[model samples]
Target: MIDQDHKLGVKEANLVSRKLQLSGIQGQEAEALVAEIEQQFGVDRVAYDPDAGTLAFSYDATHCNLDLVESILSKRGAGFATNWWNRTKRSYYRYVDQNIKDNAGYEPHCCNKVPRK
Candidate 1:
Protein backbone atom coordinates (compact mmCIF):
# COMPACT_ATOMS: atom_id res chain seq x y z
CA MET A 1 0.00 0.00 0.00
CA ILE A 2 1.25 3.46 -0.83
CA ASP A 3 1.53 5.95 2.03
CA GLN A 4 -0.10 9.34 1.58
CA ASP A 5 0.85 12.54 3.34
CA HIS A 6 0.26 16.23 2.75
CA LYS A 7 2.17 19.38 3.80
CA LEU A 8 5.54 17.69 3.79
CA GLY A 9 7.51 20.83 3.16
CA VAL A 10 9.47 22.37 6.01
CA LYS A 11 10.69 25.95 6.35
CA GLU A 12 13.94 26.88 8.09
CA ALA A 13 15.21 30.33 8.97
CA ASN A 14 18.71 31.54 8.18
CA LEU A 15 20.78 32.66 11.19
CA VAL A 16 23.24 35.53 10.97
CA SER A 17 26.27 35.93 13.21
CA ARG A 18 28.00 38.96 14.66
CA LYS A 19 31.35 40.12 13.42
CA LEU A 20 33.97 37.56 14.48
CA GLN A 21 37.49 38.91 14.59
CA LEU A 22 40.04 36.74 12.91
CA SER A 23 43.78 37.44 12.75
CA GLY A 24 45.73 37.11 9.54
CA ILE A 25 42.52 36.29 7.68
CA GLN A 26 42.12 39.44 5.66
CA GLY A 27 42.55 40.16 1.94
CA GLN A 28 43.42 37.40 -0.54
CA GLU A 29 43.75 34.84 2.21
CA ALA A 30 40.14 35.50 3.13
CA GLU A 31 38.97 34.24 -0.23
CA ALA A 32 40.14 30.72 0.53
CA LEU A 33 38.83 30.92 4.06
CA VAL A 34 35.40 32.04 2.90
CA ALA A 35 35.35 29.34 0.25
CA GLU A 36 36.08 26.65 2.81
CA ILE A 37 33.51 27.88 5.31
CA GLU A 38 30.95 28.25 2.53
CA GLN A 39 31.34 24.56 1.77
CA GLN A 40 30.10 23.62 5.24
CA PHE A 41 26.53 22.36 5.65
CA GLY A 42 25.37 25.02 8.09
CA VAL A 43 26.94 28.02 6.39
CA ASP A 44 24.56 30.19 4.36
CA ARG A 45 26.42 33.51 4.03
CA VAL A 46 29.80 35.05 4.84
CA ALA A 47 31.26 38.59 4.91
CA TYR A 48 34.93 39.34 5.40
CA ASP A 49 36.65 42.68 5.85
CA PRO A 50 40.25 42.86 4.76
CA ASP A 51 41.37 45.69 7.00
CA ALA A 52 39.45 44.94 10.17
CA GLY A 53 40.21 41.23 10.17
CA THR A 54 36.66 40.10 10.79
CA LEU A 55 34.20 37.65 9.34
CA ALA A 56 30.43 37.54 9.60
CA PHE A 57 28.55 34.43 8.66
CA SER A 58 25.10 32.84 8.63
CA TYR A 59 24.55 29.19 9.40
CA ASP A 60 22.12 26.57 10.66
CA ALA A 61 22.76 26.05 14.35
CA THR A 62 21.94 22.37 14.45
CA HIS A 63 24.22 20.92 11.82
CA CYS A 64 26.80 23.68 12.19
CA ASN A 65 28.12 24.11 15.71
CA LEU A 66 30.48 26.80 17.03
CA ASP A 67 33.41 24.49 17.55
CA LEU A 68 32.90 23.42 13.97
CA VAL A 69 33.34 27.00 12.84
CA GLU A 70 36.39 27.49 15.00
CA SER A 71 37.72 24.20 13.80
CA ILE A 72 37.73 25.56 10.31
CA LEU A 73 39.76 28.55 11.38
CA SER A 74 42.06 26.69 13.74
CA LYS A 75 42.88 24.05 11.21
CA ARG A 76 43.50 26.67 8.60
CA GLY A 77 45.86 28.49 11.00
CA ALA A 78 43.64 31.57 11.14
CA GLY A 79 44.45 33.24 14.43
CA PHE A 80 42.32 35.49 16.64
CA ALA A 81 43.72 38.95 17.19
CA THR A 82 42.04 39.35 20.57
CA ASN A 83 43.73 38.67 23.87
CA TRP A 84 43.53 35.42 25.81
CA TRP A 85 40.61 36.43 28.02
CA ASN A 86 38.43 37.50 25.14
CA ARG A 87 39.30 34.36 23.23
CA THR A 88 38.28 32.26 26.20
CA LYS A 89 34.95 34.04 26.45
CA ARG A 90 34.34 33.68 22.75
CA SER A 91 35.08 29.99 23.00
CA TYR A 92 32.64 29.65 25.85
CA TYR A 93 29.99 31.44 23.88
CA ARG A 94 30.46 29.08 20.97
CA TYR A 95 29.89 26.13 23.27
CA VAL A 96 26.79 27.69 24.74
CA ASP A 97 25.47 28.59 21.31
CA GLN A 98 25.84 25.01 20.13
CA ASN A 99 24.02 23.71 23.17
CA ILE A 100 21.18 26.14 22.68
CA LYS A 101 20.78 25.15 19.06
CA ASP A 102 20.92 21.43 19.80
CA ASN A 103 18.35 21.76 22.56
CA ALA A 104 15.88 23.87 20.59
CA GLY A 105 16.57 22.40 17.17
CA TYR A 106 16.35 25.98 15.94
CA GLU A 107 18.77 28.48 14.42
CA PRO A 108 22.05 29.14 16.14
CA HIS A 109 22.56 31.95 18.72
CA CYS A 110 18.79 31.87 19.46
CA CYS A 111 18.72 35.66 19.77
CA ASN A 112 18.88 36.10 16.00
CA LYS A 113 15.35 34.81 15.70
CA VAL A 114 12.73 37.41 16.53
CA PRO A 115 10.20 36.37 19.16
CA ARG A 116 6.49 36.16 18.39
CA LYS A 117 3.79 37.04 20.86
Candidate 2:
Protein backbone atom coordinates (compact mmCIF):
# COMPACT_ATOMS: atom_id res chain seq x y z
CA MET A 1 0.00 0.00 0.00
CA ILE A 2 1.18 3.52 -0.62
CA ASP A 3 2.43 5.39 2.43
CA GLN A 4 0.22 8.41 2.26
CA ASP A 5 -2.53 10.01 4.33
CA HIS A 6 -5.98 9.81 2.87
CA LYS A 7 -8.48 12.63 3.07
CA LEU A 8 -11.26 12.66 5.62
CA GLY A 9 -14.08 10.16 4.98
CA VAL A 10 -11.81 8.01 2.83
CA LYS A 11 -11.41 4.39 3.83
CA GLU A 12 -7.96 3.00 3.20
CA ALA A 13 -9.28 -0.39 2.18
CA ASN A 14 -11.52 1.21 -0.44
CA LEU A 15 -8.97 3.62 -1.80
CA VAL A 16 -8.40 3.66 -5.55
CA SER A 17 -6.11 5.61 -7.81
CA ARG A 18 -6.98 6.84 -11.27
CA LYS A 19 -4.88 8.54 -13.89
CA LEU A 20 -6.68 9.96 -16.90
CA GLN A 21 -5.53 11.91 -19.92
CA LEU A 22 -7.76 14.94 -20.11
CA SER A 23 -8.60 17.27 -22.96
CA GLY A 24 -9.57 20.98 -23.16
CA ILE A 25 -8.02 22.01 -19.87
CA GLN A 26 -6.79 25.62 -19.87
CA GLY A 27 -3.41 26.27 -18.30
CA GLN A 28 -3.66 27.40 -14.65
CA GLU A 29 -7.41 26.99 -14.77
CA ALA A 30 -6.83 23.36 -13.75
CA GLU A 31 -6.14 24.66 -10.27
CA ALA A 32 -9.79 25.48 -9.90
CA LEU A 33 -10.71 22.03 -11.07
CA VAL A 34 -8.30 20.46 -8.62
CA ALA A 35 -9.71 22.51 -5.80
CA GLU A 36 -13.23 21.50 -6.69
CA ILE A 37 -12.35 17.84 -6.83
CA GLU A 38 -10.53 18.03 -3.51
CA GLN A 39 -13.68 19.29 -1.90
CA GLN A 40 -15.52 16.13 -2.84
CA PHE A 41 -16.37 13.75 0.00
CA GLY A 42 -14.04 10.84 -0.77
CA VAL A 43 -11.30 12.37 -2.81
CA ASP A 44 -7.91 11.72 -1.27
CA ARG A 45 -5.52 13.45 -3.61
CA VAL A 46 -5.67 15.16 -7.00
CA ALA A 47 -3.19 16.68 -9.40
CA TYR A 48 -3.25 17.78 -12.99
CA ASP A 49 -0.13 17.81 -15.11
CA PRO A 50 -0.68 20.51 -17.67
CA ASP A 51 2.23 19.44 -19.87
CA ALA A 52 1.02 15.85 -20.07
CA GLY A 53 -2.66 16.70 -20.05
CA THR A 54 -3.21 14.05 -17.41
CA LEU A 55 -5.21 14.13 -14.21
CA ALA A 56 -4.21 11.77 -11.42
CA PHE A 57 -6.19 11.26 -8.27
CA SER A 58 -7.01 8.86 -5.47
CA TYR A 59 -10.37 8.45 -3.79
CA ASP A 60 -12.47 6.03 -1.85
CA ALA A 61 -14.37 3.96 -4.37
CA THR A 62 -17.13 3.38 -1.87
CA HIS A 63 -17.91 7.10 -1.67
CA CYS A 64 -16.55 8.57 -4.88
CA ASN A 65 -15.98 7.16 -8.34
CA LEU A 66 -14.93 8.20 -11.80
CA ASP A 67 -18.39 9.30 -12.80
CA LEU A 68 -18.54 11.90 -10.06
CA VAL A 69 -15.12 13.20 -10.97
CA GLU A 70 -15.99 13.27 -14.65
CA SER A 71 -19.07 15.30 -13.91
CA ILE A 72 -16.98 17.93 -12.25
CA LEU A 73 -14.52 17.90 -15.12
CA SER A 74 -17.31 18.22 -17.65
CA LYS A 75 -18.71 21.20 -15.83
CA ARG A 76 -15.26 22.75 -16.04
CA GLY A 77 -14.96 22.09 -19.79
CA ALA A 78 -12.52 19.23 -19.43
CA GLY A 79 -12.95 15.61 -20.32
CA PHE A 80 -11.10 12.41 -20.99
CA ALA A 81 -9.36 12.07 -24.30
CA THR A 82 -11.27 10.09 -26.87
CA ASN A 83 -9.01 7.18 -27.65
CA TRP A 84 -9.14 3.40 -27.55
CA TRP A 85 -6.84 3.06 -24.54
CA ASN A 86 -8.59 5.74 -22.56
CA ARG A 87 -11.99 4.28 -23.32
CA THR A 88 -10.85 0.84 -22.27
CA LYS A 89 -9.39 2.14 -19.05
CA ARG A 90 -12.47 4.21 -18.27
CA SER A 91 -14.68 1.19 -18.72
CA TYR A 92 -12.48 -0.87 -16.45
CA TYR A 93 -12.44 1.84 -13.85
CA ARG A 94 -16.22 2.00 -13.86
CA TYR A 95 -16.49 -1.75 -13.54
CA VAL A 96 -14.12 -1.88 -10.60
CA ASP A 97 -15.78 1.04 -8.89
CA GLN A 98 -19.16 -0.59 -9.21
CA ASN A 99 -17.78 -3.83 -7.89
CA ILE A 100 -16.26 -2.07 -4.94
CA LYS A 101 -19.52 -0.36 -4.18
CA ASP A 102 -21.48 -3.55 -4.54
CA ASN A 103 -19.19 -5.47 -2.23
CA ALA A 104 -18.66 -2.72 0.31
CA GLY A 105 -21.39 -4.04 2.57
CA TYR A 106 -20.73 -7.70 2.00
CA GLU A 107 -19.43 -9.90 4.76
CA PRO A 108 -17.73 -13.26 4.49
CA HIS A 109 -19.46 -16.13 6.30
CA CYS A 110 -16.85 -18.81 6.51
CA CYS A 111 -16.43 -21.57 9.08
CA ASN A 112 -12.66 -21.30 9.34
CA LYS A 113 -12.94 -19.44 12.60
CA VAL A 114 -14.56 -22.40 14.38
CA PRO A 115 -12.34 -24.06 16.97
CA ARG A 116 -10.74 -27.34 15.95
CA LYS A 117 -10.44 -30.38 18.22
RMSD of each: 10.9, 3.6
List candidate 1 segments past 4 Å from native: 1-16, 84-89, 105-117
Candidate 1 global CA lDDT score: 0.65
lDDT of 2 by residue, 1-117 (tens): 542566688888899999999998898779999999999999999999988999999999999999999999899988999999999999999999999999999987778798557
Cα displacement (angstroms), candidate 1, residue 96, comes to: 4.0
Highest lDDT against the true fold, candidate = 2
| lDDT, residue 57, model 1 | 73
TM agreement with the true structure for every prediction: 0.64, 0.89
Q: How well does model 2 score by local distance difference test?
A: 0.92
